[model samples]
Target: MIQTIAFYLFAGLMILSGVLTIMARNPVHSVLWLILAFFNAAGLMVLVGAEFLAMLLVVVYVGAVAVLFLFVVMMLDIDFASMRAGFMKNFPLGIAIALVLLAELVLGIGAYRAGALALGTPDGSAAPIVGVSNIQSLGALLYGPYIFLFEMAGVILLVAMVGAIVLTHREQKSVRGHQNIQKQVRRNPDEAVVMKQPTIGKGIEL
Candidate 1:
């Protein structure tokens, strides 16, 4: 009974927050509504057996709060009126792309019904794999046969991060006081260092 009430409470708030997120005139309010929706969704995930997913949702959303604030600030810079001006001009292209997607979906569904392609989901009569939680089973699967692939993915991510750092630190326009190693190395000692001849009681003018 408690679970039922909590589920309903979370689900109802999630739905209402989603609607408000779309309808709110203030972008900051919309983002706050969106965060509320995320929290309720996380709660619903917790009510289900997927505690890992719930924790993941909470951690990711909470950790990237800086990004949410950045988005709210950036909302002020958007030209909504100018974007709306292009709506009619872009409507036909959008409709055409959507129709193409719809057609693809219809064809895919028909082909699936005809069994022309095999989707590898388990059939309904398969016995439940008891004795283990979902996360444990997932970890075993990830680390058992695919550990090498997982390590390679980690390496790839490391390389990508290194590349990004190198790119950003390479050179920048209109930037103040970035170290130019070559320029510093090429400087004459006389120009680089000014010899100070000051009286004992006075300080040097910097």
Candidate 2:
């Protein structure tokens, strides 16, 4: 009874927050609402006995992704009124597209319910699968079955990261980087220092 009540409460809160996340005028407020939705989704996951998923949703989604969204929304100089005007202009087209998407989703669900689509086995069935544990299964699939694909993905990501660095990299004539490192490593006191006797009031010029 307690679990059921908690589930309903969390589900309601999640839905409410999700609606608010889309409906809020302010981007920052939308991010806050999204965070609230994540929190409630985590609660729902916990209620369903998926503690690992709940923790991932809370720690990763809420803690990291939502925070990053909040920071981006806060830092960005977006003209919300202008965006709203643009959205208003495109509202009818967007609604028509959304309705089409909704219809497609409903058709897909109906097909799925009627067993027309061949999805994988149901949640818990007595099948002799290799690894049932989340981390273990993910690791086995990543390193064993899809190792080549994984390596290719890593290479692609590496290329993208290097491309980003190359795009943002700039050379300045005033900023000496490599020369300073070389000079520091091979620095000699005799070359850098001078010993001279000077009068108390007069400074000696090097």
Candidate 3:
């Protein structure tokens, strides 16, 4: 009974949040709602005994992706009126795309209701390890047979991050108040310090 209640609560909240995410006028609010939806979906995953998936949803989607979206929305100078006008202009195309998606969804549902498509028989090659938690099992799989692949993925991501930084980096010309170490090192005490005793009524010359 508790599980059922929790499931319904999470599901309802997730649905409501998803709706609010789309209906929100403010992009930041939409991102917030999307984050909320992700949280509720994570809750549902937890209830379904997929705690690893739940953690991923919260940590990866909610923590990183949603936060990035929120920050981008908040930081960007979005002209909503012009955006709305563009949306209106592209309304027909949007509707057509939406209808195509709807048709695909309907077809998928119909296929599922009729019978699951025979993808392939499970050969037990990727079966979960017994007597271990799901996360431990996942870790074993990741760090065992797929360790090299996982390491390669990490390397790829690192390269991409470096590339992005390099691409976005700008070299500023004639930056104010910037210290030139070469100039400083090359300086002579004679030129650097002009020790002059000034008269009582006269200002010192530079």
Best by lDDT: 3
Global fold similarity of model 3 (TM-score): 0.80
Model 2, residue 77: C-alpha shift (Å): 1.6
lDDT tens digits, residue span 40-131, model 3: 99999898889999999999999999999988989999999898788789999989999999999999988878897555788887688898
Residue by residue across 168-205, what tens digits does model 2's lDDT show? 89986655444576658888876675767989988774
Q: Please list the C-alpha lDDT of all candidates, in the order they appear.
A: 0.80, 0.86, 0.91
lDDT tens readout by residue for model 1, 1-206: 99999999999999999999867766667778878888999999989988878877777874477356747657668776675567668989999999999999999999999999898887643332469877776677677767899999999999998998888795647559788889889998766656589889896644
RMSD of each: 7.7, 7.5, 4.5
Which residue runs of candidate 2 sit more than 4 Å off their true CA positions? 121-133, 140-144, 169-206
For model 2, the run of ten residues with the poorest summed lDDT: 122-131
- Superposed by TM-score, candidate 1 places the C-alpha of residue 2 at a distance from the truth, in angstroms, of 2.3
Error of 1 at 32 (Å): 2.1
User: On a 0 to 100 scale, what is the lDDT of residue 182 in model 2?
Assistant: 69
Write the number of the candidate with greater TM-score, choosing between 2 and 3. 3
